[model samples]
Target: MKQTYGYQQKARQFFAVLLPIFITQLSLMATGFFNTIMAGHISQQDLAGVAVGVNLFLPFFGSVLGIISGLTPTISQLYGGGRQDKIGFIVKQGFYWAMALAFLFIAVGWLAVPRVLPLLNLEPKVHYITAHYLLAVSFGIVPIFLAGVLRNFIDAHGHTRLTMCITMTSVPVNIALNYVFMYGLFGVPAFGGIGAGIGSAIAFSLNLLLNVWVVTHIEPFKSYRIFHHFPRPQFSEWKKQLGVGIPIGSTMFCEQSIFGAVGLFMTVYGTVVVAAHQAAMNFTTIVYMVPLAVSMTLTILVGYEVGAKRFADAEQYIRLSRVLTMVFVGVLALLLTQFKTEIAALYTSSREVQPILTGFLVYAVFMQVSDSINAPLQGALRGYKDVHVTFLLAVLSFWVIGLPGGWMLANWTAVGPYGYWIGLVAGVLVGAVCLQIRMGQVQRKFSGQEG
Candidate 1:
């Protein structure tokens, strides 16, 4: 009875953290939706160009979110376990890692972004806007890192809603900034796609600045050693972080790459078709973000519970997080399925674009469920420090079933883009199952160790 009661308590604790995180993630993704709508209004080419630009840079972008996210569970576990002194080292190292990564990506993108443009068969007009967008977004990378690390750190200490406030506080500003810049309403020159990128950068900067202010001034956080001195990167810690961080980041990169490759492959059919495809996919991505927030928040909770040696409570919370995530995703799926036509139509004015996207709308709901399940599973595994196997699982599922399967079904067969996305479905299923299996195995092993 005591164990059951304690399990229920932990589950509630998980939701308390998960709900606000979901809201924050939803708001962040809504920013992308706003950008898409704004860009879609400008021109179809502008939207497609944004799609291409994002894929080209996504692996790098995922790396920043990945690296700093490494600190979340580690710091959380330590704090929840009552090891206050060591938290400073983790924060410092994460900050340093963030700055280092920002400089590297900026240099690479600046030198190579122009070179990358012509490589794509883009319209002459899109070439300039895309280049400018790439440059502006790059400047936000470090601030993005700062924002991610801060959010993770805040969540670790059970002050989950603080990060939500920062992100939520920025949404209206982000939307307004987009309108101002994209349409040249504020006496600014009309920059189109580039304007959207600039708005995102400014919003990111604002949120990051706010995070710094609150984390330094706030209770529990103010007392942490990171405020006084950042931790020097120790191999013991870095290796531990790498252990948890690499597979996660790699899984994200792999998953994003698979879907990204799908968009790339669609280019084989033609640009407009691909543009429509991107519209549907982006819409679906925004939906998935809400569940992603749940998954991330659960990771923090699971980490804390595990660190305190409450294995059963940790296990129960994982199950609860998955349940809550599925419910949220299912609700979204129903809403998207009903109004996909309405949503896809908003992205394009053409008759041809609508039909192609219509065929893929049903897949969006499936992708959400698959993604929603897989995300929290990844979080649970990371909380258990079980990431190394995730690398192999992602590769196998993505390359073996998804990439190759997609190629075979789409190219060799006459199934078209639908056939290609079928492979994505298969990939998601495979990833979900494998990740769950791995998580269970790790949990069992961990339970025995705890015993």
Candidate 2:
């Protein structure tokens, strides 16, 4: 007889996995929150500079992170299938790939960002700050990628809390560094907005160190000997991971770069609009951690179950996660609606920016609801290793539909800045519908195979 899961049993397990991942995601998002808040307090120009800088960096970073993230599903499946011995060697290959990619990312950012920022015709001060910020943050790229590999390995083993503890511990350190570097405390010269990058670099380094400590010294993981017997780079292993990773990375790039593209486009709307846009984007992103946590957790669980050939259980996990995400996001929408003013206050004190920021938050409630549906479905599909089609879908939704539509509306219509967000809402809804259908097809295929 095949093992079965009850609703209550599934919910317990889901929360067990989801809570740690949620806390971990929150801790990670908090670092960005600190960066934004600190820069905002410095000055509107500083805040806007940080916004453009981060917008330039994150899409590329998201792509790199997405590629590295391929390790999680692969590792989860391997662990679930009882192929524990192959895990360490695989992670070694992932590390090699991460190092190579880190160098590539730093090179591209250094070479390309300066050349590109000038094309946007930003304020001279903002442009200078943006350039320096990316330069400073570049130092942390290698450690961030390496830490990503280890964190994925740990999370794949259902050890999310360990990574959470590691990340959470870094928060205070990140804040202290942010304060000192941003404000020039304790004899340190204030680099202003650029200091946010420096603080983040040091924090990323700290995270890497802590991840190394945990994997090397902790139970279960220590036995894997991930640090021992390092294997050389293999093209075949790279191909396997890249095969899954590239599409995922491409999809992430499309989705994230749209915002970056919008930020650049918003340059014409003036600095105040750009600052408000970033603030709104920042808060929505923090709220997004909830569904993102669900998505990530589903990826782990569904991948594990699929690897174990437990198709029914995998389906159950997907269904439960979607429902839970809906409920959570609904509550968040209420909070966003009720406390829009307070939330805006958290990001900036600018009277000019505050009302605009609050309006954007209203739009976020809709965007996030669609994202609740979109994120987890993608997570479930990734667990099934159904990535290529989703890549196409992402391009269609975010680029073919979202970006062009937003541009037209923003330029040709009355919506102005809000037009881009409306396009986001439409794009995500389309993606969600398409993904829902695609997920159904995958489930049927799996269910038939099981039958």
Query: Residue 184's C-alpha lDDT in candidate 1?
Result: 91
> Tens-digit lDDT track for model 2 on 1-451?
1234787887887887889889987777777777888999999889989988887788889898999888888988888788888899899999999899999999888889878999978999999899998999999999989999999999887788888898889887988897899999989999999998899899889999999999989988899998888887998999999888888899888887788777778879998999899888877777888888898888888888887888888998888987898898889888987899999999899999999999999999999989999999999999988899999999999898988898899999999989898988899999999999999999988885552
Clashes of 2: 0
What C-alpha lDDT values do all the predictions have?
0.77, 0.88
| lDDT score of residue 47 within candidate 1 | 78
lDDT score at residue 15, model 1, on the 0-100 scale: 65
Per-residue CA lDDT of candidate 1, range 230-327, in tens?
54566676666666776777777887777777777888889777877887887777677776777687678777867777787778878787778778
| Candidate 1 Cα RMSD after full superposition onto the native fold (Å) | 3.2
Residue 142 CA displacement from its true place in model 2, Å: 1.2
